[model samples]
Target chain A: MLEAFVFATILFGFFGIILKKNLMMKIIAMDVMSTGVIAYYVLVASRGGFFTPIFSGETVAYADPVPQAVILTAIVIGFSIQALMLVGVMKLSRDNPTLETSEIEKNNTP
Target chain B: MNQITIVWIALPLFLGFSGYLLPKLDRYFVLGMALLSIAYGLQRYVAADTLTLELIDSFGVTLVVDSLSSLFILANAIVTAAVVIYSWQTGKSAFFYTQAIILHGSVNAAFICADFMSLYVALEVIGIAAFLLIAYPRSDRSIWVGLRYLFVSNTAMLFYLIGAVLVYQANHSFAYAGLSQAPMDAIVLIFLGLLTKSGVFVSGMWLPLTHSEAETPVSALLSGVVVKASIFPLARLALMTDDLGLILAVFSIGSAFLGVSYAIFETDSKRMLALSTISQIGFVLAVPAASGFYALTHGLAKAALFLIAGNLPSRNLRELRQTPIALPLWILLVLASLSVAGFPLLAGFGAKTLTLAGMAPWQEAVMNVATVGTAIVFAKFIFLPFSAQPEAKEGKKYTVGFWIAVLILVGGLVAANGIYMDAYTVDSLLKALIKIGIGWLIYFLIVQRFILKLPRGMEQFDQLIGVMSLMLVLLFGMMLT
Candidate 1:
């Protein structure tokens, strides 16, 4: 059930990206999609138990922490990409004064 | 020797960062490091053994250097040096040098990294550097194009990350060597992402616009080496699985024909060259053999061509007639074009002959058709620059880089077709000559007499997204059946 929900969120992100004409909406969609991926990884990492992965005599059923660690790196990478994309959008808008898909497409043709 | 792994990655980054700190010495720093990187890469090539540098085993990030990786890094290092040399004459600011250096380091890192996480990080670094570099000139169109490239690239990376997760879920490991038991679905997912990055047809439709719109030096590197970095990993993955080769071969033929066909109708010089890159990369991706030779030769030729195109007054082919250029520059451009056209005795011919010897008859036929098409398109590019004007002086750096690339092409031709200096059989030479003749005839007869109009829909940004998604589905279906 949780997998289905995460998949749905990812799909929602894709739809938002593809369907929206606004550049800001597209960036938001990207963040949503990345978040969905992170959530899935976190869920996978916690499958064994809710306990932290740190070694301790008291906690025997610790979930896998590797996924959590990897996902953290992924999150940082995703955030930077998003930041760069936003900066690009800002610069693009400053030049054309409009963020409409049609305007951007028309401007793209050389 | 083991330290060579870290040095190849670190030296460039250090030099690039230091260049920022000392802006006056930026160009010299970048150029010196580029030469140093090449020398180190060559040293590794001479040794030619796999060196693994374990950074953090728990994180599964390690750098591995094999002969294949060594060759790739060497080629990348050489072309990057040329790019740095070319950039010197332009009087580009410190930021350009910094970005170019970062790009060089990341590309080298991508070639040598042994695990998925490091590979992922390398790709992202490349993405960031490439995006900023593409938008460096900051024209409205360049920025939009760069944004499109960034978005597509990010989406592709996400798909790749998800694939990595799937593999990890199944096998509990993230190392490339540990993917033997990985599910077919996982493999397919990974390849789908790679397809997007490889600049294949449908998936990588945004490639031409992005490549053509970037600054001249950046375009040269983009066309020459950056795209190949993505494909190197795909090639490595294909070695581990049988299904990827067959699938790759089919897509390769499609991209080859499609790219050349688009080049035929394209009016802009850089865009035409960009399209041809797609076509040639199709050949690179077609077979499972070490495509490093072809990639290296193509990088040299394409970089020189893009730089030549940069010198032209305008990008239109017709403009070449009015503009005056040096005789030696013209000669260099001609050799580069012939190399791209797969003319006999050139590096392109050597790679084509070797790759063709291994393919099935029908696939060979399709590739031949693509070659003829390549000849037709490049004939226009080469003949356009010919003028009777006196020699005009070009920058020393530009000329030097061009000659180096031309020499490398010749050297590679010798290396690729070793023994028997005239390696092309009389029959094969005759066949190649006939193909070029026929292509030229068709170009004048049909292309000029009755123009072939292809819709520019594929070049549009949204349409490319639609095609990429559709092609992913088609690829999945192909894998199933």
Candidate 2:
């Protein structure tokens, strides 16, 4: 059932990228797509059990910790990439004073 | 925990940051260190056995250097060495050197990684470093192109990450060793992601634009090896998915034709070379066994071409007669162009002959057209130095680096004679020579006459993105049903 949501979110993101003329929105769509994937990973890792992953003396079944840890690193990487994209968009907007990707090149002030 | 493995991965990155930190001493220090590192690396050849350096056991962040990767590592070393030497004069900024080093380390990491998580991280590293390098000049068009590359590639990488998730859900491991029974959707998604990075048709439309807009040496590296870093993984993926072979062959053939056709239409030298990269990559992907060898030879030759393009006084195809280049540079240009066209006695010819032995006749014919198209495009350069006006400034270091690259493209055949010699028979040599002859004839007769020309509409970003969406749907349908 959750997998369907992942698909829907990915579809939504693709629509934004394909339809949106503003570069910032396209970047947002990229972020949304990554968010969908990250959600799916966390959901899959927790399927076996719901207990805390931290180990204790008692034997309690626990969820897979790998995906959570992996997601953390992935999140950081994604954040940095987003930052870079935003920086690029900022520079682009400053140069053109417009948000439209197609118009930016054509209406260059310089 | 091989000590050499650590050195191979870490030294470039270490030097990269140090160069940034110590700008006054950066030039000589980094160059001397690079030379020293190359001297040390040449002493012993790394064998194929897997060596895993585990960073985190649970998430599978490990680095693996196997026989496959060792060869790529060797190629990367040679290319990086050449780039360092050539960029010394052209690359004015210390930050450029720093990015080059980090790019080297990131590419190495991507090549050597053992698990999906490490692969993802390494790929991101390569992406970020490449973005900086592409934007190094801070020119308006370059920044915009780099941004497009960033957005497109990052979005594509999500497909790969999602694929990894599905693979992990199916089997609780991310290692390549356990991918045999992975879900088909997961495989398709991963392949789609990689195809974007690998510069295959439809998906790789941004490559030519981005590569052509960068600084000349950066463009050389992009066309030469950065694209191949993504291909290394796809090569491994091919081994696991039997269904992918047919699809890959078809796409490779398509890309080969598209790339060469576009190259024929392109009048800008750098853009033409960029288009040819897609074509050459197509050739390598079509032949699996000799893909690595093909990539190495292509990298050497393509880098030499880009560097030569950098040194040219004028780059327009119409200005070929007026552009006065040195005799040695002219000779080097011909050698590089001929090598790319698969002329006999060159390394590309050796790779082509070996790979063609296993291809179907129709596929072989397709590759022949690709070769002809390459020859057609580069034939423009044959008359560049017709009336030498004055030699362009050529630095001694840059010239030496260019010659070394050409030497590798020629000498690599002798070095790997045992593996490739059986395929280099008299019949194969004659066939290669005949192909070149035909290519030249077609160029002089048909292309020069302007009897055939392809529209340049696909070169635009807006149109390419539309095609990319359509390709995704078509590829998904093909893979699933």
* Candidate that would win on lDDT: 1
Off by over 4 Å in 2: A57-61, A107-110, B25-62, B387-419, B451-453
Model no. 2, DockQ: 0.55
Over B1-481, each residue of candidate 1 has an lDDT whose tens digit, in order, gives 7765566578888888998899999888877877887787777778877788886555556677877776677668777877777666567889988988899889888888877878888888888899989988887787788888888888777778877877787767787765657776666667777778778877878898889889888889898889988888877777766667788889889989889989988778899899999998898887756476667667777887887788666687756656666666677677778877878777777767766766778889989999899889888766664556655545423456545544554454435444123538887788788888888888878764544567777777667656656866887788788
- C-alpha TM-score for every candidate: 0.93, 0.91
Q: Write the per-residue lDDT of candidate 2 for residues B399-481, one digit (tens) a residue.
A: 56555654544454345444456766789888888877877788777776673456656655566556656777778888777
Question: lDDT at A49 for candidate 1?
Answer: 80
- Chain B only: TM-score of model 1: 0.91
Question: For candidate 2, what is the lDDT?
Answer: 0.74
True contacts kept of each: 0.52, 0.60
Q: Is the docking of candidate 1 incorrect, acceptable, medium or high quality?
A: medium
What 10-residue stretch in candidate 2 chain B is worst by lDDT?
B39-48
Clashing pairs in 1: none
